[model samples]
Target: MTHGFRVASLCLSLGLLVSVVACHDNKPAAETRPAANVDVINVALRDVPVVFEYVGQTESSQQVEIRARVNGFLEKRVYTEGSLVHAGDVMFVMDRKPFEAALDAAQAELAQQKARLVTAQANLDRVRPLAAKNALSQKDLDDSVGQEQAAAAAVEGARANVIGATLNLGYTTIVAPVTGLSSFAKKQDGSYIDATNSLLTYVAKLDPMWINFSLSENEMLDLRTQTQNGTLKLPPIGKLEAVIVLADGSIYPERGYIAFTDASLSSETGTYLIRAAMPNPTGSLRPGQFVRIKLLGALRTSAVAVPQSAVQQGPRGAYVWTVDKDGKAQQRAVETGEWNGNDWVIKSGLHPGDHVVIDNTLRLMPGVPVKANLVATPPAAVNIGGPDGGATGGQQAGAAGASGPAAANANAGANAGTTAAQPTAASGASGALGEHTALYFASGSSSLDAQSADALAAVARRLVAEPGMRVAISGYTDSSGSQAANQRLAAARAATVRAALVVAGVKIERIEMRKPAQIVANDPPDKSRRVDVMFSPAAGG
Candidate 1:
């Protein structure tokens, strides 16, 4: 009976062991799966600006050498080193005793000559009366008159010497020749300075500081081809707006404009020279300051743009990882133009509705399946207008009336054109019905670049298509220069734009030139210095 009971217990234990083994073999598959997630943005088809960013350096608009005009010992250093000074302001003072003595001697010499002239004149007067009364011969009277004339000439010579001496005395004090920041003095106090060749110091004009940059020959050729092919359009020569990016990655508060462009490429560097003028009211920007320059007033039509972080540069060139319809990431080679802030303006290799991987790029591989989470793209720059979809009066009104959080976005739209109003995110409403573009200009400049011309051509076509539609062209200028000058410049720019529109086949009477109620100061000079063209719908339609 005991043996039978033990056998039954052993069978029960075996059954329990078998059930535990089966449960271990049937473990859940959910906990072991890997998470394949990535952040991405959908590539949208729209007009992207053809902005060119180049590493540039700041230079003094004008460099004036400070030199001593008179020879003397430097008595005192009146100006502090590295200080600002104005024209005709005293910078240094030399010992004036010697120059004063010289002037006194010249004056004394003139007085002595005057006394001699008086004696000669008295003798001449006596001789003249004697000759009249036949008491003196003709030769005697002539001699006395000649003596008087010689004495008078001596006095005049002495007077000229006194003037020279006086000028030398005044030169004892060295003064600034221009209004600008001063450099360190080369000649210290008590140092003997040569009148003709002594170098004291230099003063550099800081306002309207010059920023010079260069572009390679190959890049220039590529730009030319792009323009000729209608892929890239640039603003006119004077209208190209510039902005300075400092070494610390901060944009300068003051705006800049293109001041000069080289006529020919340099053989040594194989690059063309480009110079810009930046306002330096506070002397924050100095000569020789290394900075980055952004050239606006250019637009790229029908170009695809992606976040700069999404693009990767390799030995073969630039490329981005795009997600396919099957949810697999694909590596694509892309042609890139310039950076519009954090976004890369892709000239080629992208299409609308394409998904680009922005984050987790390192973990991605070609053909690897990914779960793409659409990320919101940043707002684009304002004032970069497109063909038919530019800054219109209606858009401006929408921006003007935008309140609270939307005001910033609206103002951005006002500056850039209608693109800013477009959906920055992929999940938002589709893009605006038409393509609008805005072309910005530099301070006190109305000249259009190639891009501006293209934009204007596009606007002209729209006007021609609709006969009743009229455009209101308004010009503007920065507050760096004189107010009256800005007004004139703005007016001239408006008129110039009007003339171009007329030449493009738009009726002259239909285009209206309007003036703004107030010109805001201390704003982004590029945005402030622009010609806004607000389109009016067809009157009869």
Candidate 2:
């Protein structure tokens, strides 16, 4: 080891031994250790989706209640219960003795009247000749003509009565109005049932069952916005597919389609009713059976996400650990949305390529050395970011344009060695009330420099000057060692900064500490370990 800021020696990991030749003119230069970490990006953006889900029950397209049409004794049912029957199929037969007798009597009267009409027609035929010859008195002939007309009218009335009686007898037999499944008849043999009695049964058509559901106004609005922004995707037209789930949790294989939608919203529920038609050939589905409808909407636009472990709460707000060039740890603030379990959906403040910690959260830091398991990331994680095949992003553009974690690691290694220009950074400060915070690391660790205390002290001074101002610091480590070690180191770095602030007159109550980011790398994860501080109320003024 060389003393006084200029010492250089290297240790090799595997079993490689090599020595460098001594230089004759030694004007010493600072030596740098290799960084084993990678760089990564995290960003925040809204990912909208077009969702279709609602609960509904199966219903028959047509149903009819069977009732009696005439008063009579209960008769035999022509069809079995729950059996399909065609239109005009007889359902019940009633006693028709009284109607049959009335028909017979009317027919007999019509016969007697028809005989009179025949006699009158014969007389009129003879009288026409006599009137021309003047062989009979004109008054006598006219009288015969009047008698014939009366008999003809009586015969017509008798025929009409006969037809009415016949129809009355037919009404004793009940028929089905439509083709459908007939429920059990309520009227039994020997029971008196008629048009005025209780319902006999019901018939329902079951070939194409209807599924009804509702959609709220808010849901409709969301769908419209997604379509406009081109974020959420759209499926086929009336061909929108849906899954039916019964109460048992098993998936229904049969597919259903959108049959119709209500024209207006319902005032009671503030929703519009939608109906889907499903084929039920075997009649496996019953009318009014409750079921859940699962519909898959269009795809979503591209989005980047990182593990919750990678994000830290700093004075400025929320940020993540990013490995920069030279394998150094850097704090990057991030905006995020929903929690995707092991990962966080970054809404803003992240980019395509970014190395993020996924496992061993306790060992992550800005500049601490970390070793990524090297296991390829998975692609299909139920809307997860990427796949081991290197395919990621929900949106096509995101998948095509986004960089993988490997690229981020490479970038971090390149950035770790150089520090940002201090003068330029300081000059960017807006005002006296504004405070700036920078991460520090352990000696030779880059994870969090032992000098973090000095940086935090400066933050403390700024906070006191601006009483209402708030500050946040995020810590990170380089990927130079084990991920576990890096996380601890990263956490310690943040604690040190907070301690420094406390000693510098900043209140302990005002400080907050957070979990470390898992940066993967065996060498420069140390550089990735760091704490980023932020001020509230827009800082300065």
Maximum-lDDT candidate? 1
TM-score of candidate 2 versus the correct structure, residues matched by position: 0.48
lDDT per residue (tens digit) for residues 442-512 in model 2: 45342333233323333443554445656555555555657777677677667656654543335666765
lDDT of each: 0.68, 0.57
lDDT of 2 at 134: 94
Q: Which ten residues in a row have the lowest lDDT in candidate 1?
A: 423-432
Q: Which candidate is the best by TM-score?
A: 1
Per-candidate TM-score against the hidden true structure:
0.52, 0.48
RMSD of each: 24.1, 26.2
Stretches > 4 Å off in candidate 2: 1-51, 78-90, 102-168, 175-179, 228-230, 233-237, 297-541
Where does candidate 1 stray beyond 4 Å?
Answer: 1-46, 118-149, 195-197, 264-268, 305-339, 342-346, 349-541
lDDT per residue, candidate 1, 433-474, as tens digits? 123334554443555543453345445545654577776666
